[model samples]
Target: MTKKIGEPEKDMSFLDHVEELRWHLVRSSAAIFIFGIIAFLMKDFIFNKIIFAPKDPDFITYRAFCKVSRFFGTDGLCIDKIPFTLQSLEMGEQFSVHIWISITVGFIIAFPFIIWEFWKFISPGLYEKERKGAVAFIIVSSFLFFVGVLFGYYVITPLSVNFLGNYSVSELVERNIKINSYISLLRSSVLASGLIFELPIVMYFLTKMGLITPDFLKQYRKHALVIVLILSAVITPPDIVSQVIVSIPILILYEVSIFISKVVLKNELKKELKNG
Candidate 1:
């Protein structure tokens, strides 16, 4: 009998598996650190250009919004000023924020490699067909993550900044946005969106485990819509446009997840039929 690819061809002890996982984690961490160093060196471009892009009126999203507003003859969508200034009050706040931001950026930059390492570790337990899908898994997951990051940066971040940056309980109180606060918002928006975009991947695993089916997704789609709306509200500002913008992609992802579950179930059934 021929041994399958990724199969050890011999039973490995628990300690051996643990050692393998540790090495995979070590490699993933090294990749993150290398990317982080690069990000740290490019602080000027990262912070001034990328992180702070949404604050400027000429940001790509803002420009698109302006053009759309003009075409519709509606002045409501045009954002002229984000009525807040970012300030660092604590003496070490800027340094701390810089380090954290670089680390986060590094993780984002190295995400694909990290995923590859994880796949390598897990692939040994998967079937030959599943092992063959490694490249597709990494590519699709990476593409989805980057897309989510861009959506958060260009859409959710701007809307939140515009709303919170301008919102004032009273005319007496001026918005003095702290450096840490701003960075936190930016980090959360990007990271949260990136993870949320992995819905289909999550569904595939759940279906494989026989935990959820496509019928379940369809039956509870209304409930999912309500949850998505609540999630949009939590992530975005209190504006309808921002909420709608965030909700749309998430809803689409949910539908795609359902389709993924259906496919997974179909494949499993076919496998069982062939074996029987």
Candidate 2:
């Protein structure tokens, strides 16, 4: 992609900037397609093991929960089957699901490269120091994203499937869930966490731009807690225990972000003093 040129005041024409962005979009699309093809070829691994895993009684998450419950002398997660069965109403439903799921999988695997392409596009406009410090952007961001995805897949998704799938009013009422519904839950949980784990990165940029400060974060600490609790409720099952458990790590991340903001502010001050 062509670099954005000219000074801050005399920017590249809007069309020129758009043209440059177009090329980046094109490259990113091609990358996603390439990865999608790879995912399509791995159908057995993707579907049997990964996608349908939560439906199995002996899935790793269920086993882990069972172990925890046995140790604590509480109710365990072991079950013979989910009360629900997945079905496709449309003729092309399975094929459509396969293609879309493959593309999303492609996006996840190609995420680092996509972020690198974004950084490349924006690097030309950044000061040298800013660019240097951001050399690890793709690696760090990708690591956080994968961590979030794992958390979602292993913890959140399983908990949800177990709780919701087994919940019933009576034996007369059987749950017949759709494939789309199940996949949607898994996808949303994974993608949301993947993006949420970039919290520190988002804070870092705002800190660098002087748009946010440690003091600001500290001032709104209680408010942040409420927001976090609300967010936890939104994403997780309606159980308070589950919400609290998930919120803990996220709150910890916010605290860490505050520390990072403080360090960044101090460094900025030192640089100013040195220049002066």
Candidate 3:
């Protein structure tokens, strides 16, 4: 058995691997379609509540920020309203949004099956022990996605909305955000975070490829920190607190990735020693 995903098996030809991959993709697409149907049927809950959630002043993030401001005895996040109106600018805009949003929702909901498909495609080449651990792939990936979504919704989306909505050159300018633009912000934040949260998984695959090493991660530790901080700054507002909050989690994940990489390398070394 091979050590990780994408490693070719001894008996498996290139065409065989391609055929296997094709099936995996097909199954994953089917899962997404199934979930999309469900999302299409649940229009009221998806549209009226979840999708439009951040636009409402009574959103959870706003309430939490207001509480924090009150607890400090002064004021910070005490916004009366978001001060922006979302409008559809095209005749088919609303309908287009509905279709795409349903597809996106379907994709998110069917993520576990997608991961399973990926695992099935690759796990055939892994060692038995590694293959066993791959069973947790779907669960961990789904958990990370949910956490990232929450982070984007409560932290990223609200901060972005507040900053961009309130930002003005003069009193003459009014902020009337296009519905697509607003949704783009929300979608980007969520998808970006969701992908970022898979840092550990990325590290695992890289380690297997020998593209990443624990010693290398440790040697360039300061450099990685700088990059992480810069990324945090890019994703978040200019405030130190927000950047720190985002950077801290990523640093933790990097450290965890280092540890996981080390563990894997250690086991491989031990197996090599035994073979020798």
Give the winner by TM-score. Answer: 1
> Residue 103 of candidate 1: its Cα lDDT?
92
lDDT of each: 0.90, 0.85, 0.82
Q: Rank the candidates by lDDT, best first.
A: 1, 2, 3
Residue 7 of model 2, lDDT score? 29
Predicted candidate 3 versus true structure: per-residue lDDT over 90-144, tens digit per residue: 9988877778787888888888889988888878667767777865877887888
Tens digit per residue, CA lDDT, model 2, 78-102: 5667678888888988888899889
What TM-score does candidate 2 get on C-alpha atoms?
A: 0.92
Counting clashing residue pairs in each candidate, in order, gives 0, 0, 0
Write out the backbone clash pairs for model 1. Answer: none
Which is the leading candidate under lDDT?
1
Per residue, candidate 1 scores C-alpha lDDT tens digits across 33-149 of 999999999999999999988888778888888889989988777888888889999999999999999999999999999889988987777788878899999999999999999
| Regions more than 4 Å wrong, model 1 | 1-4
- Output the lDDT of residue 33, model 1: 93
**Could you give the C-alpha RMSD of every candidate to the true structure, in order shown?**
1.5, 3.2, 2.6
Which has the higher lDDT value, candidate number 1 or candidate number 3? 1
Stretches of model 3 off by over 4 angstroms after superposition:
1-10
Q: Write the number of the candidate with greater TM-score, choosing between 1 and 2.
A: 1
TM-score of each: 0.95, 0.92, 0.91
lDDT of candidate 3?
0.82
